[model samples]
Target: MTQAPGGGTAGRWAKRDASVVWHGFTQMSSYLDDAPVVVERAEGHELIDVDGNRYLDAISSLWVNTVGHRVPELDEALRRQLDLVAHSTMLGNTNRVVVEFAEALASVVPVDRPHVLFASDGAAAVEQALRIAFQLWANRGVEGRTSYLAFGGAYHGDTVGALSVGAGGFGTEVFDPLRFPVLRAPGFDDPSCLDVAAAMVAEHAHELAAVVVEPLVQGAAGMQMAGPEGFCELAEVCRRHEVLLICDEVATGFGRTGTLFASEQCGLRPDLLCLGKGITGGYLPLSAAVAAGHVFDAFLGPDPSPRTLHHGHSYGGNALAAAVALRHLQLLEERRVLANVGVRSAQLARLLSAGVAPLPGVGDIRVKGLMVGIDLDPPGPAMRWGRRVCAAAVRRGVLLRPLGDVVVLMPPLTVTAGEIERIVAVLGQAIAEVTAS
Candidate 1:
């Protein structure tokens, strides 16, 4: 076995991974040199690799983790659920923990009389929301309302339905044949995004089933953000048109946006809400498609009626995941994690402004709560500045990932002040080193 710099075990694991693992969004041919971090464990907000290198989780393990890793209450919740039962079907029956978690989630999510339909991941949740929105019109005896309205630079998920509505990028162009096109609106990158979207809604309201959005920030679009007022205005336009509004808070939910859900900040009580990522505090895979009372009511009818929305996953509402998610939700309030998010967000803004923004090749820095994106100057095809800078930051013990030329930083809500400083300092140095090269 080839020995890595610090350990042979990591090298062996990497070799084994290269042989058997077909990772998504990765080019397997050059995976070793490009992406080499093999995480062994996590503590608080840091990830320990197999080579004993510790890297601060600046992207919250791809924007899922919230409170921190290995939180005691979350751990205990999983253990408690494991003792009772691990796997149960939510098809015909429901479990206690799932019901309790949904109840807890309903209390916080910005949907009137919310009823949750559990799914295993964000894509599945988004897919559920899309189908629910489509079927709601059919169930209400409404015709021609079969289309959807989505913004450019929007990313809901990777599933077919979600991808159909999503603004296509991320090498998803190859699947263009399979994706069903939606009524496209300009994204937040354009100042007139809301104006353009409202116009589209006004023009197509008769045939549009729903207007789907990422609320205030489109994380996958390099944290492209819209004003909360714009979001409220869009919601009003959707309401005025009598069209459903689906808020995909997969990335902005669970206090990531300084609010439990971004919809809360926008004062949007969406007809359907898609939530995931931090729901289980990164402990397990759990997502929910929450429907308003009216939306849920539309699907109800006599037993075995065709009005029922036919969709489900085998692992939907797993007891352990639900239990951990419930505890995570409780801890969010008890520990006042959102308050930390507000303070840390300010610290991050100041640190980035004072430290990284002046560096060469830095174009723009966008931040909403702890979710951040630092857009680098446009690089030539041969110059992967964002990737190189992130790799440098990783070597310096801060793990950062990039979306093309946009360097993203989505640190855990519980990241300490000192840790935030370290992340910023390392990022600045990394940017300098890469730019100088």
Candidate 2:
């Protein structure tokens, strides 16, 4: 075990971390016993621990870092904005960077007259969209349309409103009492999925506020993918039923799925789009809930009447975050990130299907642009092959975090072909080592 450079011991950080921080989704009882690695610094595609070991960041720091870590442009953008303003409430007033970000986003997103409502992170974006959906209905004289429709195996987020629609996951067990009722349809790719969704809309159209989905790929749900065929079909269903379609593109946005936005691939425009993660290239925490003109129009009324969407975070449109996001968008356009994602996505799919998927214990391999998922059959003991693979990959100097039983990889969009090859090579070796042992 590597120790910290400070005097007392190498694992001091772990002990200190364990003593104070209660990590999310972690079993803290055995935290220090296993000696957690404390990250000291990061560079492009690499993270260095306190012990001075370097590891390739195969998961892009939980699928956020697109332009890569410590980029000069993003750092400078943040610094420049910080020199002016850092945080502000997104009520009554707006900042210049925030306005620029909204304009840049509107130019790329599919909706005409797209208006952005800022938030701080992915889950917050989900919450904002949910509230907007319900508020739109209420403002339109449809006071009964408060229930939402979500797919089984969907994972929108962890917040109360987000969790309400996130079915087929154990995460909501503790919060079930507090969560609102949300109708669940059969997940995409199920034999009767579309039929099930149609039936739900038919049965609940009068009461449906919205249908939220992780468009194209359901990231937290084992990276389960549904092609554009069903997505376009679902869009039509939502339109016909007058149910607002909310595309949770927090994971698939910013060219992660070979397109600037996954909704574009389906030839469908969502009523509300939730974007985060790579929006600021992982430089700062930022998210946006974009709505069409019709949706936005629903909230326009006299000031004292209070028909507005009643939600705003303290740091909703932080100027630094907005500036960073603007710079990141510029970088994406300048580099033609979608083109790179397309090329690398195809190469990764071919390489993994031909090489890694055939290995022992490897059951299935799925790829979408820069995002990839490796499902291990039977999952074996430890019960979560994906989590084990992540730990194993770390030992082999590759940083990865898996979703349930899926050993997933979502590297930065800026990664080179050579880096892609090395990432896959190390991932394959890690899979073999973990499965073999």
Candidate 3:
């Protein structure tokens, strides 16, 4: 393989990165050989590496970026917050920006009379939700409702509490000793998953604190998706059983799945909603665990009361993050971003079915709006077909990543039609080349 023009510069950066930067889910020893792209800046939906090579951000920077990189509105929001204050503890006192953002968030989230508890990332949000749900039962003087019900192939987060309820995969099994067990249900791969989950909820309702799910999509499980009706059925089951329903929308929120929240499409009123990723339009790290009014009321008590659910992050409601997130939320509506998502989603479905799905080695293609996964049938274990295909796409100026044998393509919400075409064309060519090899 040939290197780009600034190979020397990229090589130096890669060496420096390998020496000090221990990236999560990466093997540093082979990082240099992998031809890692060291990004220096971003423009619109493209990432410019140190080598001056521009690659289309096919996965929205791992499904976080929404309105695109370097958005002017998001940048100005952060600047405005900086002029007032940057950091303040949410433990005792709350900042004005935080309060305003929370109000704005509450207006849009699917939960009724939602109360926001800020966190720094998706895992923290899930952890907070888990704790809140567990304590909600205890606060209500409900005994024996101590367990949680989660579906298989669920990827909530990596924190101990989050991982406890999450279905273990992706090299997480080694940490089984640290994770607590939950009542596991089948994933969406099985057509009867919802039926099975409903039955589990009925049988375990007496002991289940909450029925946690990813709503309409299980992103980390190779973009596996469930029908809106299926989610509605599960919600109905939870309601019938008198069990709380927690929607882990960390991946599906902020118009990733053609809706502000997947629960909205499913007609679900989750007791708790976990949001992250695009909350700040990828400008900052911020997440929130939104609780319904009833859930919030359960924790209400006098000062220093044991009924208080005590958990918070040092940078929980950072002013800058809140300000940016509030502006991002506004921009989503003002710019009619969800409308674009609908159009782009249709285009993507057409392109994938016509261009990529029939390519050699392509086994299955799963798509829900912009989130996509292409399952590849490798010739053998040594082929590493998914990684090789993504590498080939990168060489063609398209950035992509794979989940084992599943290649994902999740472009920014603001991506243009031409960019989508380029992504699909490159992916198709890459798959063809790798399979023919």
- Specify the highest-lDDT model's number: 1
lDDT of 1 at 164: 93
Candidate 3 residues lying further than 4 Å off, grouped into runs, are: 1-6
Candidate 2, residue 181: how far the Cα is off, in Å: 1.5
Between candidates 1 and 2, the one scoring higher on TM-score is: 1
C-alpha RMSD of each candidate structure in angstroms? 2.0, 2.2, 1.4
Residue lDDT tens for model 2, 110-218: 8868999998889999999999998887788877898999988888788988988888465558778888888988775474665678678877889999988887787
Tens digits of per-residue lDDT, candidate 3, 261-319, equal: 99999999999999999899888899999999999999999998979989999999889
Local accuracy by lDDT, each model: 0.91, 0.83, 0.90
Pairs with steric clashes in candidate 2: 3-10, 4-10
Greater-lDDT candidate between 1 and 3: 1
Residue range 1-437, candidate 1, lDDT tens digits:
11232345676788888899999998889888765788899888888888777888999999999988889899999999999999799998999999999998888888999999999999999999999999998998999999999999999999999999999999999998999979999989998898889888989999999999998899999999998987777888899999999999999999998999998888999999999999999889999999999999999999989899899999999999999999999999999999999999999999999999988899989999999999999456759898999888887888888999999999999888999999999998889999888
Question: 2 or 3: which has the higher lDDT?
Answer: 3
Candidate 1's displacement at residue 237, Å, is: 1.7
Q: TM-score for each prediction?
A: 0.98, 0.95, 0.98
Task: Give the TM-score (vs. native) of candidate 2.
Answer: 0.95
